[model samples]
Target: MLQIITEKFFPPGERYETLHRAILYTNYRVMRGEKIITPIGYLLPSTGLHSLATLTCEMLEKQEKYPDGPKLGVFVATTGDDLLNDFAAVISFFLNVTCTPDPDLTRRLLLAERPSLGIEAVPSRFIRRMFDKDVHARDGEAAALTAFIKQLIGLERETFVGAMRAIRQFVIGSHRLADDLNLAYTLFVTSIESLAQGFDGHVAEWSDYDPRKRKKIDGALKDASDEVAAGVRDAILSNEHVALARRFRDFAMAHVAPSFFRVEAAGAQGPISGPDLPIALQQAYSIRSSYVHLLRDVPRQLTISGFPEATEVDDRKTLSFAGLSRLSRHIIMQFIARGRIVEREAFDYRRELPGIVTVKLSPEYWVASTGGFDHKTAPVRLAAFLEQITAAVLQHQKDAKLTDLGPILTMVEHSVSGLRKPSQRLPMLTLYFLFHQFAGPEFSCKQWPALFEKHKADFDAPTVESFVAHLITGNRVEWTLEQLEELHKTYFKTRHTASVTKIGLLLEAALSLYVAEVNRLAGNNARARALVAFAVDSHPGHAALRTYEASLPAELAEINWTGILLPPRPSSEGPSADPVPAA
Candidate 1:
């Protein structure tokens, strides 16, 4: 624990913009909740949180920060900093444990201290800025809302903290992206998925296949080679969408609240009782899958957030986003309350490490914005290069005909070789997303006629822009210049869509770096300089490219490539933005 607490720091002249952290004790108290102790101190038993004022506040006589009115909840953290995340998490864990889903729950989500006019700064980096002030939840409208919470529950201190942390983030996300309904809904589901991953009895079922056939299939795989068996196993389990959907729905059903069907939703929204409940629940997960893999839209009712918000999709598969949001919170609450213990050693304390790389559940699994990174941290900046490339691959996986996936694997293999483990925030899936963000759906890219030759390989690598500008351009195929040029235009250029997204900009910059490396290796220093210069321009403030440019031979480093025009090469992979979720 960093014993020295400090208020949110702002640039010298922006002290007025500096928001102070104030812990106001609300009238609400935790019921059946016991005191929780951490290394530095213990949370007031009723609140399940400890408030430590910053040193700056102790020394200065600052103007009043928050309003004089009383706020919501047992624990309300009014911070203009990252610490609000903790407030959300603690409140979520507390509510979950206590089974007190107050109808005014949304009021309790006041984590950030934003100016009433809204956040003024144009974000220059990754950040988590505001808290949702949506109408407070009306848990009483749904009978099952708080039905599952048990009395006198005992959860391991570690399990309690971990659940709190994960929920805080996902809940924040649900509110943050509430406007982008699909992504917001997905985040809500992912929050539950994160909790489900390590759930007890979370058996690694190969697939939800017929048991009779499954037994034979298991036998068939008995003597198979490791790679062959593993591949087969993966193929068999590829329909995890169903398993996950059923897992969610079944989890809900297995613990059906005693009063779940006692009443109808307040609005004329379709019924979620009897068969409708499970169907809507399953459909919620189904809608989540559609948005995830195909970017599909949600049912109309689900898109609009409202009171008595649970909508029945009688004509289609559906659960209102609000309905799902409330459901997810309940599931999480029940999950944390039911989970009495998790092995103390099971916690990934690495998350608490002081390293610049702070691993979080992907907002892309309930991931959130990471903070505290700066130019001094080389790996975080360098990791962005690969991170963006992974984003590109995932974005184009379906349309880019980018079947030459092996090249990026080699690129990642080469790039990550000397990287420290801490710097490797890259998720395990970077076939660009192998670093993070990629969910390993079978992506589509144009395959050369002879490429089915790779069917037996580990994965169908969506190779670098179909090998036209692949760094190892000639490694596998003998492409005549004409074929290379034609393929490059038809696939990489024509099929590519323009993107103005932040991720798109970074992907464009990364591809420029990708080409720069290729050109440099090819001894085309001038072109390499042009590419690097373009990359630097596209993604300003990148440390890796800047360092590489600074280290250039003194004479060449002095040469300006900015004004010089270079012929466009047929092999150049240009910028195109495809929406890639966070890695």
Candidate 2:
């Protein structure tokens, strides 16, 4: 009966092969009238076994309704008699509920049981209930676990099941003799490798599906070429290393291991040493390979000895087993954590919007931003601006002594990439300007005005208009050296109000100086002094502008040209007050 069911439902695979052998073994015991006992209890009778077989067949036919039926059936048929009674009871309840008149209630019951079916299903209802109750107590964690399990079933069922089976065998072998130690170690390491592969798949999916993130990762990988090893470079760039145990070693070292566990350097005379996770994983894998390939003179003694006098080998095997076990658990926990984050991102609109935008714009902006003015084009513009500014600033920093601008530039880049609203773009630009003001030299002050003038048509009317109006207003205003000093202090601090006020004053001062220089060369000494007075009083305190003021003819400064506003221009734009003459 078991053979027929296996043939009909179970596919031709390693799992199915194991199920076939288990059923044959079970039948052989039954024919000899041998009673089996498991951890839970004694086995069921022939009649109960027949009933379970019949119900399992029915469930397999309706596999859509019982997606976990195949796995549960294999587990039940293969396990010892001690667990049979509980499994039999579960099968009986399922049969009864599913065959009842109230199909709706049956559906609800089945839906409720689905989460625990594939991974947690066991013979005993009591054990299953305890597990279910615990899961319910931690609903958030349970949801994440469920998502991980679902992902495992969909993308990596073979590896996931293989890991679980290996875990079970290791648990059974731990209590046995030293003969089983090799099997346990091999299974434990293999399980860790499988979980790491699953996590790698998750990360790959996230990268491939999200183009913006992929581009960023690619850029980082390119930048890392000179810093990382060849293998690591290939892994990061191609994502080929993620599925390997070596990658897990790197991940564990970075995120899981403590500082002391990472590396230990001996004295200058001794060789440097470290407890490298990847090296351990590699050694274990080599042992497994030796066993698989039937290598000659294989080392059965699982121990490392620095000297012959110290013959302590037994505990070494135990430690190896413990380390591998703990590592496997950590890998599984990391997978669960990653799944939880992905699940949260998928459902939360706020977290998903940026990725959505990336996906929508990827085709057009993959190489560069290529769209006209629109809501979608702002990010591209912001990206271009950030790139241009960052490159220019980095180049400037090479020769100039300045405060570090890397953090500010990084923040601006992140803010622009994550921008979802139009209002955020200006603030980001403002912050960029502030950083540039502090980090760049005197020449950098002219960069923003040039960029603003160049891109004025791209911005809204209000933004462009406000800037132009400030320039005009500054040219017509009169000022004293004290007021100019205050504006200089404010501008030095990169305060927004000061930036606005001082930028216009600086432009107006440059024009005034140009006019004064022209008049001075033409031998109009009085007109030159008047224009010099306006430039000095309106914008005298700036460190960069002070050079221009000092270069003016000495006679002009001795004349005490102060409190003048641009020599009273003609028409309605003329100065409101009389120009203060030399003292």
Worst lDDT 10-window in candidate 2: 20-29
lDDT of 1 at 40: 19
Residue 5 displacement in candidate 1 (angstroms): 13
lDDT of 1 by residue, 219-324 (tens): 9989889899878877767654336666666666654554444432343234355566677777777877898899887666544334333555766445655455
Q: Quote each prediction's TM-score.
A: 0.38, 0.24
Which lDDT values do the candidates have, in the order given? 0.41, 0.35
Clash totals in order: 25, 2
Q: Give the candidate number with the greatest lDDT.
A: 1
Model 1: how far residue 22 lies from native, Å:
1.9
Supply the TM-score for candidate 1: 0.38
